[model samples]
Target: MNLKVAMTRSSSPANGLLFALTSAGLYGFNIVYARIASFTGASGSAIVVYRVLLMLVLVGLVAAILRSSLAMEREERGKLLLVGVSSALQGIGYLSSVAFIPVTVAAVVFYTYPIIIVLVSPFVEKTPLTQALVAIVAVATLGVCLVVGPAFSDLDWRGLALAFGASIATAVQFFAAARCTRTGVVAKVFWIQLIILPTAILVSLATGQLAPPSILALAPFAVTMTIAGYVGGFVLQFLALGRISAVAAGILYCAEPVVAAVSSALILNETLAPLQIAGGALVLAAIVANVLLEQRRRLKDAALVPIAD
Candidate 1:
């Protein structure tokens, strides 16, 4: 099916929200697995390489089953290539940072996407920042700081820097994706993973951490789950983004760390202090508030338009 058909089939507000939440849950679970693999002595680059390689195979099977040919126009191929390279860079930077820092710290730093989106909005959308959005942004920033503050002294500065850098790369990838979708979704994803496969492999090998998985080892299973989660999460993201506005989608994505923290506590037995819990609550509230306001505005516009028409 075409992208438009897929999106239209699930474009209701309720469906969009569910799809976005599903994406976040899958991504959160993936993060938990990645952290587990990392703690078990799998190098970050190695984990990424394994997951990307597996995802390539899995996604290929999915494409074949769907009878979808993975192809893009010559002009679009360049953008897809850039997206792939950016995806790899984001992965490398994130993994490298996690090697030095706590998973939560790295996660918080990478979750700075909302701020980046807000900063980039004027240039891309030619829209002025409203006061309410600015206030919510401040709340979100404070929440991030609170969440990471207790662990600040223990954080690896280099890791923090790399993690922040990765956030920038990811933000660019997201913005670029909004433009790239004009061509095709699966094609873009296929091309991005194509580049990711080699980039991840090269980084893994260069780090001297590219040991093939042992038959007796559990890391392979973890990597397999990670890749599965990534593919599902990404496809859901494509679906959600196509139906919702970028700002709304970005705000919803900002809630990912909360989901991550909860999953970390449950899966990894990680603890969050009271302050951290409160901070996470604030972050959730900020996202909820944004969505509520947007919904209200849409409703108001709809109610007024019928009388005028």
Candidate 2:
């Protein structure tokens, strides 16, 4: 029985990594889906409004069906609400960036969130910074620069700014979520969608960007985004965070841009410059190195813990 229990414990983190990778793939598809919706005349804010509304209804209904309590302590509610606001900002900023820049560039910029998290870890996560981690982050940053640097001169400044904003907002959202008290994944996501829905609605209305698409255009994409992106991607992401360290999850999420770039090339007829290709390779290498180093560190730490007989 003890051996069985130990095996279960050892398997969970691996499962969490699998969940994170699955979420990253779905998120990559979400980028493609968003671009398709944009081609079909859906504005960024309009897409956010639609997607958040759909997620709210779906998650809420599932929670109700499960008889899950949506209640949280007042302090936890406030933190989760802040996380929701950040998520909304990330959605708007990232989608708007894609509106003005190539998907690859926008994705690379948005991926800076992992670096941001690492940089701020000492303050927010209270984790010690090691030279090795810093070096890995630097390589990732260099990789991103290589990928997007050439296009930087041609892209709109507004798009760059929005992408950067999205990166910061995403970093904050993840950190905040990590700090929050334990809550059901569905309930947490439901509350986040609840906060995002009204904000998205107001933004779409205020900006006069709320033009509804044809049912033919809206139906397929809406269902796809709601199921694959929100339910499959983000719900799994939250679940993974419960099992793995936030830093591990963030590093794994670096897979997203690579997936997006490949998907864009295949689906959207996008091509990367040779330099960009090299940069992407570097980014993938850095993410792999980070993951391996983190695993090693975890093993070392575990070895140091005294086993009780």
Candidate 3:
């Protein structure tokens, strides 16, 4: 069966929402595993390097089986390179942040990308930025303040900074993706990972952090779970982006941090302060409100279109 047939039911919003939720959930779990990879002995840079290497191999195999070329035209290579660089940066940022803070904290900070996308979309995509959108971004920013402020004493400054940086890189990747032609989603992913793999290796080499990953007090290869999760989450992510608008997919990603919080509590025994939880709630509420308003806006715009006779 085609990968698209398995991942998407159709191009409808509901299908997109399903793909978004599933992709986010996988990513949420991957964050926990990445932290575990750290505890088990893998450095953040090492983890990203290995994950990218493995993902590129697997995605390359898939592309080969599908008879898809992994090469980009010279015209498209610039955007592909940008997307790849942003992906590498985002991966390093998120994994590195987990080394210094609780996985849940990293998640909360990184997920600010949804709001970032909305704020920047007008400039990048020519979407109108209405006053209501401004108000929503304000509310979400306040919520982010609440969420991160209460945990300031416990969170490492480096981790918080890294997580926020990841958010920016993620937004850049999404915008770049929006401009890309939609053909060969899997091929696009393979090429993107190919671009990232070398960058990861070079960074690891320069920092002298280029050790092979090993887990302590477990099966030697257990850390491969982190790499596996990275592979799966990325495959699902590109599929989701192919089927849905970036903003819609981003709004649905409100579930990711929630998934991270809950999983960290259950698996890692990490819990948030009451105030931080409330702030996270406010951020999600703002996202939910945006979802509703966007739906209404789309409906209104649809009604205005002339019906074909």
Candidate 4:
């Protein structure tokens, strides 16, 4: 059985699904926008800094709206600090990839996280990897190969490494988010962003590549990408996750690459080859299949529960 199947067996499937899909959409568009911003000659470090700054303020407003305490338990704070480090690494990896590769290429590489999640699910989610699940994984992986094959020749090994690094960091993000929920939702989001801003700033300063965006250039992207689209989606996700399971939430995030691919093609004028599109479709289908299988398993388990005497 799939991990996603086990996750939905819990009490909050609807909310979990909603949270996951919303995060995927926000993250998809965030990648496209950030990639476009990177193409404008801003250093990757600089783009990350600016983006984190925006995220900081946005997260702050979210905390205020909820009237939640930003304080963290000492142990939780320690874990959150670690999550911050991973988040910072992910930001740098993603920004670096966008600097050297097409957004679609970067997105494809990062999309490998689903595979990673599946691989790790046995340990964390405690689900057996059935033959059917393995078959699905194989098909999905073949799709990834086909999608990425056209760009293989042009692979910047550095960019590819960064993309993989980002994937690892993203996997960590889901793990940490799930772990941190024992605390409070607002606090988790708060500390993650809180640690992110400082970490990004320090990294940018170390690289000596940080730059202030010109007022004119910052305004449009700020409103369209950062505020209305990216942040809005993220805030919704954070809120929804508080009411749902993180693993189930992570599965729903499967929609991201498709949205990112389409947006990159339309907005950045990046061309999508037929093979790549097919691969992306395969990945999407695999994710959907995984989710459905999990749901079925959960339904079966729930049906087995005995009524009170």
Candidate 5:
């Protein structure tokens, strides 16, 4: 029994890594689809509204079919609501960035959220500054500067700003969601989508940007977004986290930008400047280093903990 349990534990992280990679692929493809939808005249706000609504309806139906309860405690509901709002902001900012910049550049910029989270942790969680963190920050900053060097002349300033904003919002969403107790993944997603629906709707209405897409265009986009991007991607990430340490999951997530970059090049004929490619490599290295350091810290903490009697 002990050997069997050990084997299972060892295999779980491998499975988790696979799931995380799958999630990254889905998300990368979603970026491409989002760009296409936007080019077809679907505003970011409108796309978000539709995406969340479709996911909510579809996930809710799955829950109903499984006879699963969608109820949540009051605190969970509040946290999920905040997560949903942050996610909506992330979606709007990222999609807007894609409209004005190449998908690969936008993805590289957005992936800087890991570093952003570390920088803001002092204020948000009272984490102390460490030399390792400082070094990682320096490296990441250099990477970002390289990546954005051409943005000043070649890319729209608004797009650059939006990409950074999306990164920050994504960090916030991840942090907020981390605090919540585990719940049914589908149910949790359904609730988040439920909260996002009204927020997106109100934003679209208030801005008078709620230009609905043609049914022909929207039907396919909605199905793809709901099934492949939102549901499949999120579900896989959730499952992966259950089996692997978050540090390992973060490392797997680093593949997302690469996948996006390659897909954009093949599908959209987008090419990155040599400097930008180098910058992307540096950024990815910093992220990988950060995750490794975090994993080490976690192991050290675990070792220091006293075993229960």
Candidate 6:
């Protein structure tokens, strides 16, 4: 191929879907990887520390390569750094939960962030609280309940609480990310990940948790897969965003939970029961519906605006 052709991205929508779906799969695999780390004797806190350090290194390299600057106005930059707090919580909560529950279950619950965002956007983003959104939240909530099953007593409550708490933090993360448009994405990612350093270290000290992985956790295969899943996933996510609308990306990202379930089954020998599978499908459907619903409302609002001419 010529240089220009090689330099240009594929304009085909399918290409974007491929990138988005692959990223989703990588993210899905990350859940199982965290579980593996925990099973190999790494604390949840330690997993975050290790992963955060890796991300900081990778993202920092990318930022340096592109000569990206973090010189944005204080407010916008502050918003970006604030995203790290929720991100750390998101990582810590879900990773911690996987130690006590199946990765599939932790993922299923954690994926409810969009649903939580829908429930709170009215107060946060001033988005209208429409009936469709309410119904979407209800359906997704029911799906989570079914996935968790009625026997709540038997399951570890700590995992459920942590996973759900992560979901809430993820919702808040989305809001912070939305308001942080001034900084370049790469720069923001690096800085945000760097912000996780002090917080993660502080968490390690506060909880008296180890910050290093075991020998098994750092094995060639384990380290390779975890790094690929997170760092690679982060790269492909941006590639997908560059190629497709955020709305399309959001819809395709419903693949994340599906990926988590399948990968856990294949690699980790963990499978969801029939009812739980059905529940996951319901949750996915609601998430897609929510994305579509929001897009339609935005379009309608745009049409209502009178032309300046």
* Best candidate according to TM-score: 2
TM-score quality measure for candidate 6 = 0.74
Query: Which of candidates 3 and 6 reaches a greater lDDT?
Result: 3
lDDT value for model 6: 0.68
Model 2, 226-270: lDDT tens digits are 346756888888777666666767777877766667777888888
Which of 3 and 5 is the better model by lDDT? 3
Against the true structure, candidate 5 reaches a TM-score of 0.73
lDDT of 5 by residue, 1-309 (tens): 355665565566567667877897788667666666667666667766766767777887888899887877676777778777887788778866977887556766877776666667677667676778777766765665565453334877788889999988887776676555566677678777877778778878987877664532654753356346756887787677566543345445655655556576777888867876786687678767765775576556555655443
Candidates' C-alpha lDDT: 0.71, 0.75, 0.71, 0.68, 0.68, 0.68
In model 6, residue pairs whose N, Cα or C atoms come closer than 3 Å (at least 3 residues apart or on different chains), thus clashing, are none
Is 3 or 5 the stronger prediction by TM-score? Answer: 3
For candidate 3, what is the lDDT? 0.71
What ranges in model 2 sit over 4 Å off?
A: 1-11, 73-75, 97-108, 147-150, 154-158, 213-227
The true-structure Cα RMSD of candidate 1 reads 4.1
Clashing pairs in 4: 5-294
Model 6 weakest 10-residue run by lDDT: 5-14
Ranking, TM-score, top scorer first: 2, 1, 4, 3, 6, 5
True-structure RMSD, every candidate:
4.1, 3.0, 4.9, 4.7, 4.5, 5.9
Question: How would you encode candidate 3's per-residue C-alpha lDDT over 163-203 as one tens digit per residue?
Answer: 99999999888777656665467778878978888878887
Candidate 1 Cα outliers beyond 4 Å, as residue runs: 1-14, 73-75, 100-102, 148-150, 154-157, 296-309
Best-matching candidate per lDDT = 2
TM-score of each: 0.84, 0.86, 0.78, 0.79, 0.73, 0.74
Give lDDT tens digits, candidate 1, residues 111-216. 7877888778888767577888877877876776666543665766899899998988877776666556555566666777778888877886788878775521
Residue 227 in model 6: shift from native, Å?
Answer: 2.4
- Residue-level lDDT of model 4, residues 1-309, one tens digit each, is 455655554656556666677777887777677656556655556765666577777667877887877788766676677677787788779767866777557766876776676677678768676766766666666666665553545777888899999988977766665566566766766677777877778877887876766632754563347445666665666665555444455555656666677787888898888977887788678767767876776678667764443
